[model samples]
Structure formats: C-alpha cells, structure tokens
Target: MNKNKALFTLTLVFALLFVWTVAEAGSSKRRGTAGAMELLIPIGSRNLAMGGSDIAGVSGVEAGYWNPAGLSQINNRVEALFSYQRWIGDINTVYAGVVAQLGRIGSLGFNLSSLDFGEINVTTTDAPDGTGETYTPQYLTLGVTYSKEMTDRINFGATIKLISESIMRQSASGLAFDAGVQYSMMDEKLRLGIAVRNVGTNMRFDGPDLEIKVQPPGTEPGAAQRPFRVPLQEFELPAQVELGLAHDVVASESIVWTVSGSFLHNNFSFDEYKLGTEFVLNEMFAVRGGYVLAQDPDEDTFYSLSEDFIFGPSFGFGLNYPLNATTHLKLDYAYRMTKFFDSHQLFTLSLGF
Candidate 1:
C-alpha cells in the first residue's frame, strides 16, 4: 500500500498546525486551498507483486475505478469490498465497493469513498478570532460502472462518478468518468490492461459567501433583474491514464509468483512508472512490495517534499480463505513509507462469490 499522497493531502494541514504552533509564524499565517485531487493510492496483491499496478486485468468492484475491463472475468455472482486507510494522524478514509452480474449482458458495480477532516473552529480576522462557528471539511466520491467480455482475451468497461467536497458552510461538486480495456493469455496467467480516469469538467463552489453592499429600489439598470456573479472560474480536473501488465508463475497447485508493472500518465504534471512483485505460498499467505518513481520536469524534485515524491516504496502481506472453488474471502494489508513523512497503512477485506 502507498500513502505517498498523504503528504500531498495533508500538506496544507501541516501549514495550519505550524500557524498555531510557531508564534511569530502564526502572525503571517497562510490561508489557502490546495490544488489537485489526491491520487488514489493502491494496496493489494494479485497485482502489487508484479509492479505496483495492473491495468489490463482487474476483476472486482474496486477495479471499477482501477480498470473496468477486469469486470469481464466476473463469475456471474456478487462480490464486495471494504477498505480502511490510516493516513498519518487524525485522518481516516473509508472505501466500499460492490460488483454484481447482470444476466447475459455483463457485470455492474458501484463504489463509494469518504474522507474525514475531523473538526475545526471557523474564524475570521475581523471577528478578532472566534465567531464560535466551527465546521468539518469532508470529501466524497461515488461511482457506477459496467463491464463486458467480448472475447476470451478481450474486455471493455466504463464508469461515471459524482464527487463532492464540503467545508463549513461552503461546498463544491462535480462529475467525472473512467474507461478501461484488458486482454489475457497464457491460460489466464498473463495479462495486460489500460484505463483513463477523472476525465471531466471542473467543479464550482455554491454556498454563502462574502456579500457586497448595493443600492436597492431600481437604482441600477439590471440590478433588479440580474444577480452579480463571482463566477469562481472552473478549474482543470485531475485526469490520468494508466497501462500495466502482469504474469503469474504457477510454481505448483499450491504456490505461485506474480510480477506487475505500470506506466502512468499524470495530465497536470509529469508521468510515473511503478513496479511490484509478490509471492504466494499455498494460496493462503502472500508477501509483496513495490517501488514508484515520478518523472519530474523541473527535476528539482530530485529532492522535494511534494507528493511528487511518490517515489517512496511500499510493501505488505495478505491471507486468503477459500469458501469454495468459485468463491472465497480475502484480507489484505499494506504499508508505504515516504522519504519525508509518516508511513501509511492499508487494510482491505474482499468477498468473492
């Protein structure tokens, strides 16, 4: 699992705490909003050991966001997952996803994720500090997807999503989409995949704001018929493209080794390359690790604390329980260490029918 993004997500918070901790520094406190949607960190095997990625062969509701094409391999039943992430301190995130077969058509899935910002008191410079108002900043994501298998080695899928970010009295909302394709060979042991996600328009804020004073009673021309607009210019959405491949070596009926690699395209910035590998013992125990390197343009990041340093490495283990030949239960755990911050932990529960 990788929490590299945590550094980026909490970047502003560190500044917030600095304002409260460092006295003189607090005098010139920085008040601002962070740009960019944090990346979706990953922590699971069956893919991680290969190279920290799998674009062409995802097979669960979580894959709906990772790679929809994996949906082609659904077993005509229902599968679901719940994951908890301990990102640094005071920041906890939860994710839930489900996939179900749709008759002879294909497979459909849903996903939801929530991010909690804890609680903070709201204040303004003029109120001389506290207006006694407080609020929490929370973010949410919801998506639905459909996938179809066209051939033994080919699959296609797509998803639509709703995103919301809310703070004390203010909020922003938007929509996005993801699409994927996957192919497999070597008796379903070798695979490849590709996906494009978060490709959509920007979001705009809609809430009470600092109002302006104006004269009434038709004193102005269109003031009575039209409203003044702040038009918080819609900004660019976080868009990404990913390609990955994986291969599994069946050491025996009970043992297997898998390796995977992924090429990522970060639209708003430089690209990234990630690789991972895992070993499974007796289909019950697994161990995995991965490394990620960012392609920096400024190259100054050769030593920067920006989330751009996803360059750190990650590792973890997992346990799987077979309910039957076509179904089972799995628990996966992962950890990631950044070059300049607290490590992250990821735990996921999966149930397959």
Candidate 2:
C-alpha cells in the first residue's frame, strides 16, 4: 500500500513539473541576453555520450554537473572524474570533480571546470590594423554540491557555484545555485529527475580594461588627463529547467539496457528535446547514441534545418575495468555532430574507491 502511495506522489510531482515547463515555453524574447553563457554548456563525457540525457540516471561525481540528486546514489566511498573536451573554434576545456560519501549524512562534492580560448591578438580603435599584442580569455567555474536520499525512492540535492571570466586586465565574477530532485519507482526501474540551474546574481565585465585616461573637451593637447571608467551593463545568467525520464529496459545479472528522454526549458533561448539510449554488457562495455531537436526555427530562412544551429546527432562508447574488489576505472568518449565547423569530442576518465 505504501509503495502505491509513493508512486502516486511521484507521478503528481512529475505532472506539476511538466505543466510548469510548458507554461514557460515558446518565449523567444531576450534571446542571447544572458552572460556567462558557458554555464549552459553540458559537462561530463559519460552524460554527454548519452546525448546529455543523464539527468535521471547519472551517478557519483558526474552528478555534480548533470543532476545533483543522482549524487545520492554514490555507492562508493569516493569517486572522482577528469574530463577533456575539444570544443568548437579550437577552444579546449578541462573538467574535474570528486564526490565523497559522508556516512549516513549525505554526499559532498567539489567540482572545477576551466576553458582556454587560446591566445588572440588584441585590437583597439587606433590599432585596427594590428595590435602587436595578444591576450587570452579564461573561463572558470567552481561548485560545491550536496545530496542526500530523502527516502528510499526519493533524493534531493543542491549546488552553489562560482563563475569567473577574465580577459587581460578585465574580469567578472558571480554566484549561482542549482537544485534538483530525483524519484525512483517501479522497483527502481523507472527514474524521473527535475533540475533548475543557474539561479542567482547577474554578471558584468569590470577591471582595468574599463579605465581610460581622457582629456577634458576644452583642454589643450598637453592638458592633464582625467581617469574615466566605462559603465558596464549587467546581464542575467543563463537560467533553465530540465525534466528527464529514464527506464531500464533490461536489468539482469550480465546485461542491462536503458532508454532516456529529456526536455529543457530556457528562459532566454529556445527549448530543446533530447533522446538517448544505452546498452551495457556485463556492466563492462557500453555503447550509446542520442539526438537533439530544436523546438522552433525561422521557416522563412533558406538555410533553416528546423531552425537548428549546431545540435544534431551524437554517439559514443564506454569501458569499465575493475582493478580490485573495491576499486574500478571507467573511460567514456562522445562525438557531437554539428552543422558548421568541426564536431566536438569529449574524453573522460573516472575512478571509484
């Protein structure tokens, strides 16, 4: 009887989340208005390999970025992950995280992600021809997460993240919060997850780059210059909500198969749908595939492919090796197809102890 009640409650929560997502959908206003947009980029190769559809099924350290609620399922005492991404436009990213169990209390996680934009020539109004100087833009994020199993079938988690963006002498910093819930039903074969991310302060650029020495309008050429600073505009963070569902098709001693789907609601951009599937053999080897769909597009444009930009199909593979009774290593790789430029590739390694 209790099991039935629990299932009923879970269904009700899912329904409410779905309705809330739909109510906020189809608003194209304020597109590209958000700053620190990099936060919207998905992390964790294992989750990305599954087409960024692991919001309901992620486990351990990867949960810090995908769905913190999944961190409650950390079976191991300690889990760590290191990932490298070859992003678009020759940019590179390094992501790392660790989650440690806190006995009966909960799980604590620390994550760090950094992006290197490489060196580029700095140009100014007077140096449009050539600046002869170069500068590198850097993006970094740090997060602390916590998760606990509220009940046998329910989990809750939250994250506090700090974002930093720097270029030459100018930089901006802000904080954001993420909260998520996960519900498991039907003997843990069905999973549902809801997460709201990047809810916090707005960001704007500042620093020495904004300062300039200017002469008064009536002053002569040799007159002393006064210091003036450019006023920067504040922009909202990339806030979004996600609803994901996953079901185990085959749960056996030696083989397991799963299928998952997710809906993303963006406050400043178009909505997206993700579908993914994974097959595992003896929990050692796996293969996965996924596709992304854009909800709206400019049909009048000649190049409209459903109004999609870079999101297309994605595929990946994984391997898991157990070194000892209490230790294991895992590797994951993913390929994301794009409409322009080169495709993105991610490689990740994880250790469990």
Number of the top candidate by TM-score? 2
Which candidate leads in lDDT?
Answer: 2
What local lDDT does model 2 show for residue 241? 83
Question: After superposing candidate 1, which stretches have Cα over 4 Å from the reference?
Answer: 1-51, 127-129, 214-230, 298-311, 323-327
TM-score of each: 0.78, 0.90
Q: What is residue 211's positional error in candidate 1, in angstroms?
A: 2.9
- Candidate 1 lDDT by residue in tens digits, 1-353: 12334333333433443343233110112211213264354523344433457565557766776787786575539888888877665577888888888866988888888887687777878776778877888788888889887565667788888888877656788788777777677887888776777767677776666244454665766564434545565555666677788888665788888778887765555556877877789979998888777665334243222564633677889898998898889888877775445677778898988
lDDT string for model 2 (101-187, tens) is: 998899999999999898898788999866898988989999999998877888878999999999898899999988788888799
Worst ten in a row by lDDT for model 1: 24-33
Taking the candidates one at a time, how many backbone clashes does each contain?
14, 0
Worst 10-residue stretch by lDDT in candidate 2? 297-306
